[model samples]
Target: MVFSNLPQQQRELPEDGTTNLWGVSRLSEVHRVPVASLRPADSPRHQSEQAEHTHLLANSAQELPPIVVHRQSMQVVDGMHRVRAAELRGQSEIRARFFDGAPEDAFALAVRANTSHGLPLSLSERTAAAVRILTTHPHWSNRAIAAVAGLSAKTVAAQRRKLGPATQTTARIGRDGRVRPANSAEGRRLAGRLILESPGASLRAIAQKAGISPGTVRDVRARLLRGEDIVPLRHRLDENGRGGLNENRQSGERRPPVARLVAAPPPAPGRDEGGVSGIFPSLCRDPSLRLTENGRRLLRMLELHTLDGQGWQSVAQSVPAHRAQIVSELALECARQWQRFASQVRERAVAPVA
Candidate 1:
C-alpha cells in the first residue's frame, strides 16, 4: 500500500509551535531532502534550525500517528516524499488516501515523493515493498510490482516466497510469552487425510505419515473433532506421571467425526444374484444401473421390450441375490428420474426459447 499525505501547499507557519502541520508531519515522518529543495519563501534563516527542526519533528515524543486523507479512491496523489523519508528514518507507519487516481498519477507521486523532498528508501526497502505489493494484490503480477519498485521479477518472487501468505501470521508467542510455531492446521489436515485412507492405522503410523509427533497428531485429531482450537498443554507433569502431556488426560480418546469415514462402493456386475445368473429387470430399464459401458449394451441384448416378469426373472437369475436387489433398486430410481428429466426437457424444447 502507498503511504498517504504530503505537506499540503507550503503555507505560513502559525504563531504557535504546533501548526496545521495537521499531522502532515506529526501524523507522518519528516522526510529529509536537500535544504536547497525547499522554497526560500518564509524559509528559516539559519540552516541549522532547518535540519534541527526536521530531526526533532522526526523524533517526536509521541508516536507518529497514521495519516488520514479524503479522496474518491485509495490513491496517493501528493506527499510521497515525506512518507518515504519517514520510512527511511525507521518509521513503521505512513498514511495515504484511496482515490480514483490514474496509474500514471501514482508513478509521478512516487517519483516526486522520493526525488523532490522525501528520504530515499534503501535498495532492500524498495525490494521488500515490491514483493509485498504483489502478494497483497495477487491479480497484479510480480513483474508489475517489481517494475513499480524498480526491482527485478526474480527478486520480487524471492521476497514474496519469504513473506508467504499476507493473511496468515507466522509463529507467535502465547499468553506465557513463549514463542511457538504454527503447525496445528497442517497437522489436523494430515490427520484427516490419514483417517479417511486408513481408519485402522496406528497412531504412530499416522503421525509418521503426517510428519508430526504422535502426541501432536493425537491432540490435533481430538481438538478438530471436538470443534475446539488446538492449544498448547497448560501444565507439566512430574516423575509420578502427575503432569506433562499424558498424565492429566483420559485413556479413552473420543472418536473423530463420523462423517470422516469412507464408504465402500457396491460390487461390480457379472456377480451372481440370489445364487442365479441373469440380468436384473431393473437393470434392463435403468441406464444408470449399468456401472460400465458393457453393462449398458447388455440392455439391448436382454429383449427387455418383449420380456415382462418371466424374462426379467430369467435375466435376474444370472446375478447373486444381494447384488440383484441393490442393482434393481438403483436401476428403478435412475429410470424414474431420467423419465422425469426427459419429460421436462421435451416440454421446454417444444416451447419458445424466450
Candidate 2:
C-alpha cells in the first residue's frame, strides 16, 4: 500500500527483488526480511520508551511503518521500537525499507529518525549524539554535524572545541563531498601559485579552487602584494642551487605590478572669479566631467563659438553672466538623456519572456 502511493519509478519493483543500493533513492516496495537477520543499530531511544512502545504495539493490531535497514549489513537504522514490537508478537519476519550506506551513515539516519518522531531525543542526548557524530565524521563541518544530530551549530562547535587541537587539524569535508586539506599550509601554497599565475583573478574564485577559506586566500594575496614570500621554501628552490628569490629581477622579466587602491584626484579649481570662459575650470581640467562623447563634442563646439569674434562679443554684451550656467545645464541634460536611453534599451533587451 505504501509503495502504491509512491511515484511510478519508486512503485516499480525490481525483477530480481534486489534493488541497487547507492546514493539516495526513494523508498520502493518493502521487503519481508527475516526478523532474526535484522540487527539493531545504536539507537538514540531510551530503554524505558522502547519498552513502552513495545507494550503499546503488542495490544494494537496496527501495522507499523517499515523499519529502515542497511542493505549490506542488514542492520536496523530506524524503527527499532517496531522491530522490538514484532519480536514481542513472536513474528518470524518484518517489513523493511533498505538504504545503501556505511554504518556511520546509518547511525546519522538513526539519530535523525529518533528526534523527528515520537518521544524526541532530549537536549543532553542530542548533545551526546553530536559529540559522537563529530568523533566519527571529523571531516564534516560543525553545521553539518549539527544537522544530522539535531543540535545547533553553536552546540556542535562547542563539542568540537572540547575535542581539542587534533580535531582542528583533521580534514574538512565540504557540502560538495570534497575533502579539503587537514591544515591551511597546503591550501596557502595552492593559493599562492594561483595568485602568481593569474594576478588579476578574483580572490573568491581562487579560494574556491584551492579549497581554502576566502579570508585565507585574501591574506595570501595581501602578502604577495606586500612582496612577502609566503610560498613554501621547497617551491622557492630550483633544480639548481639557485633560488627563485631573484626570478622577477632576471633579464627581460617583468614582475606583476602590485594592485593598490588609488584615491580619486581632487576636483579641479571650479570656476574662475571672472567667469570669462563659458566652461567651468573643473570641466576644463578633468576629462571625466565631460560625462559623454557628445557632451565633449558640444563643449569643443562652444569653445570654437567663443573664439569667433562676432559670436563672442554679442554673447558677452547680451547675457555674459548666464552664458556659463546655460551651457553647463545643457551639457548635464544631454548626459542624463543618454544615460536614461541606455538604461531603457538594456531593460528591454533583458525583459523576461511571458
Candidate 3:
C-alpha cells in the first residue's frame, strides 16, 4: 500500500529541523556500511531466524532490498536480518537505504515498515509500538494511529481510554499523508456564496470548488431556494461600538419585518374534502407524508387553475413538452409509491401479533 503524505522529492532542511527524503532514487542506492558501525534503534521485535531470515539466506546468492538506516544516528530502522544474513556470507559491509528524520519518527517508520511487510510484529510488540505512537502523536485520531501502528481502531481506542483523555487535535492526516483541518465552516461559506451567485450550478461542481462534501452543498442550495438566511448571526453594534439588542437606540429607525413563507397548517384532519384529499387521499390523511414545499406549491397552483375552470387539455397544451414527459414521470413516481405501500401491507398482514 502507498503511504500518504511522505515526501517523495529530495530537499534540504534547516540544520535544526528534520528533513524527509523518499522515493526510490534516494532509497535505490545500496551503500555498503560497516556492520560494526551500525546500531539497532530497538531490539528486534521478531526473531531474525524466522522464515524471513531463511528466505533471505536462500536468496543471499542474489540481490535483496537494502536495509533502512538513519543518516543522523547511523541507527538501523529496518532490515536487521538482511544485514546479519549478509554477514553470515562473510561480507564486511551490507547494502543499505538511508532516511533522515528524528529518532522518534524513524522508530515509527520502522514499526510501520516491519509490520506491513515480510514478518509481522508480535502482539506485545505491536501494543508497545502503539503506546509509543500514542504518546508521541497524541493528537492523531484512533484510526490514524491504527493505520500507522498496524492495529484496529477499536484497539487504539481502548488503549486511549486506558490512558484517559488527551489534548484534542483539529488537524488529521489523511490516507494520502496530507494534513487537513477538520473544520469546514469556511468551505460551507464559500459554497453558500457560490450557490447564491450561480443558482443553477450543479451540486457536484459547487462542492468541488468549495472543497466541502456534496451533501453539505446540496443542503446550502436547498436553504437558499427556501429563502432562509445563510449568513451567521452577529451581535448588533451601535456607532460607538457598544453592542445591544435595540438597534433603534442608535439608528432611530425600526427594520422592516422580513417576509418568510410559513406552511399553512395541513388542513385539520378531515377538512380537505374538496381539495388535495380528492386526489392523494392517503397523503391528505397523513400530514407528515407529503411532497416537498416546492412540489406542494406547484400542486396548489394547479388546483387554483382548475378551480378557475382551466381544462386539463388546455393546461397540458400550454406546457412545452405537451405534458407527456411530466405525466410519465408522475406515473412512474406513483407506481413506486404503490409498490412500497403494497409491500408494507403484505408485511403487516403476515406479521405475528405482538
Candidate 4:
C-alpha cells in the first residue's frame, strides 16, 4: 500500500530568533570581512538608495547591523546600504555572516531579511521581489513567499496566478516548513478507498497512505459507514472551478497538528445509567474490556479523561497567571490527544476486528 509522509514529531520554531525561510544554516559564525573583497550590490531593491540616505546611515550614532553574504560569490545578500555606509566612513572591514545555499535561495533569504529589519522596501520593490522569488521558489505556498516579500498572501496568490504554468504545482511547502497538497479533495478519495479495502488498518497508517490527517482518515471511515461523502461540502471547488487551500483549515497542517497517539478500541457497551456520565459503566460491563490486559489498560486511560464540568473548572482555576499562556497551549494540545483518541475509537469500532 502506498503511503504519504507524516512525521512523528512536527518541527517547532526556534527560540534563537531564526526562521525556516532561510532554508540552510549559516556556513560560519559572524566574522569580519574586507570591505574591498565584497560585491557592491545584490540588493532586493531595484534601484540604489539616494546618496543622502547612505550618507545619513554613515553618520548614524548606533552601530551598523551585520551583512548576510553568499560565501561562494562573496556577494552581499542584504545590507548593501550598510556596506556602502562603511566605505563612506572609511572603515576597512565589516562584521558579516556567511550563507551557504543556492544563489536563488540566497536571494529569497535576502528578501526575507530586508523585509524583517532595516529600511522597508517600497511596495513596488517588494512586489518585484515577490515575482523574482516565485520564479525561484515556485513550490513555496503563497503565505511562504508573502512572508519573505512583505506582501499579503492574497497579493502573492494574484502574482502566482499571473505566472500560470511556471508556478503550477500540486504540493507546496508552507511557512511551518511542511509540504502538503495544494488541495485536499483528492486525498479524501484515496482515504475512502484505503478504508474500504483495509478495514483493520490503523488510522495513522491509513492517514500516511491517504496524504491526509489521521483525524481526516477517521472522518472518511465514519462517512463511509454512514453513507456520506468523504470530502466535506465546503472543500468542493466553486462554480468558477477555482481550487486552493483554506488558510484557516487544520488540514495539511503541522509544524499536535500531526497527532500520533495509539489506536485503541472504545470498549463495547454493555450497561448504561444514561448521559455522558454513563459511558464508563457501559464499558465496564463489556466482556472485551473486562477480559484482556490491553482492554483493561484502555479502560484505565479513558477514566483519566472522564472529568465532569466542575472537575475541569477546578483544574482550570488552579493554573498560575504567569503559566496561563503555557498551560492553555498545553490544554489545547491535550484536547487534540483526546480528539485523536476518539477518532481512532470510532474507526476501530467498525474495524473488521476492532
Please, what is the TM-score per model?
0.23, 0.47, 0.49, 0.56
What's the true lDDT of residue 349 in model 4?
A: 88
Ranking by lDDT: 4, 2, 3, 1
Better of 2 and 4 by TM-score: 4
Cα lDDT tens digits, model 2, 1-354, are 222234554322222211122123444468998999987767765553457756776566556667788888888777766777788999999988887777777776677666555446888888888787777777777666676667888788778768965455346665445566645566887888787678778989998999887888888877655444454442343333223445535644544542222222342355233443434333433323232346556455444432434555676567657587887688689779868977996999999988
Task: Find the candidate with the highest TM-score and give its number.
Answer: 4
lDDT accuracy of residue 336 in candidate 2: 90
What local lDDT score does residue 1 receive in model 3, on the 0 to 100 scale?
Answer: 16
Looking at model 2, residue 283 earns an lDDT score of 46
State residue 11's C-alpha deviation in candidate 2, in Å: 16
Predicted candidate 4 versus true structure: per-residue lDDT over 1-354, tens digit per residue: 000121222111121222566653554577899999998557778775557667767887666657778988999887787888899999999988888888898888877776665666889999999999898889898888998888999899899879887886788887867777766778887887777677789999988887777898888777655445566755655434454346324345322221122323353355223544456656654434443458667777777756666777998899989999999998799889989989998998888962
Model 1 misplacement above 4 A: 1-141, 148-150, 160-318, 321-333
lDDT of 1 by residue, 221-330 (tens): 56544434343433222333222344334644332332211111232464444322334444443323232346555444343333445667787788887698798898
Best-fitting candidate, measured by lDDT? 4
lDDT of 4 at 196: 61
Pairing residues by index, what is the TM-score of model 4?
0.56
**Candidate 3, pairs of clashing residues:** 4-176, 4-177, 5-176, 5-177
- Model 1 residue 147 CA deviation (Å) reads 2.2
lDDT of 3 by residue, 241-345 (tens): 323345454567554443333343343554544765345433322222222355445445434432223454676566676777988798689779768967987
How high is the lDDT of residue 142 in model 4? 89
> What total of clashing residue pairs does each candidate reach?
29, 0, 4, 0
